[model samples]
Target: MDEIYECPQCNQKITVPSEIDRAAQLELAELVHMGRRIDAIAVIIAKYKLGLLDSKIMMAHITAQKDTCVRCGNKLLEDGVTNCASCSALNLNWQ
Candidate 1:
């Protein structure tokens, strides 16, 4: 079932799919890093059914583990490979 959520940023009601287990964790982190905290929290809340505080905590944990592949969440090497050697995902320099 889809759940209706209020956007913490825009205050707009959003319908979130219940099945978001496959949603990229790195995507959420990127959102937070890009100053889209509300969008990232919304996804975390919907995906985990957690309250706002917990969602923020989850986002912190996800973002803290930096240097990961955005697509597969694999740990990225310090090497100068622009692309993730493991998943071929673009190694975005979030720093």
Candidate 2:
């Protein structure tokens, strides 16, 4: 029977044979050395799941944002406060 594992990157579950754990482990190790820490952890976690090994993978999801200040940036969210957290300037332009 094929084992299913959850991808820590995109959160999509996948299936692979238990025997491929070693190869997967090697690939994940390379990713870590490349500074792709999150991706590496995801691959290792998936491989462990397929190998029927006990493992715990913790990952935090971060949403990307532009460099502009919160108020200067687009009106992404509506808050009752009038000042911007990033620049601490009055949001007079807010409408």
By summed lDDT, which 10 consecutive residues of candidate 1 come out lowest? 7-16
Cα lDDT of all candidates, in order?
0.53, 0.37
| Best candidate (score: lDDT) | 1
- For TM-score, the strongest prediction is 1
Which stretches in model 2 have alpha-carbon errors above 4 Å? Answer: 1-22, 50-95
Question: What RMSD value applies to candidate 1?
Answer: 12.5
Question: Model 2, 1-95: lDDT tens per residue?
Answer: 65555433345444444554445534543554455766645654665453223221211111013222223454433332133454443221211
For model 2, name the residue pairs that clash.
none
Report, for all candidates in order, the number of backbone clashes: 0, 0
What TM-score fits each model?
0.41, 0.28
Score candidate 2 by TM-score against the native. 0.28
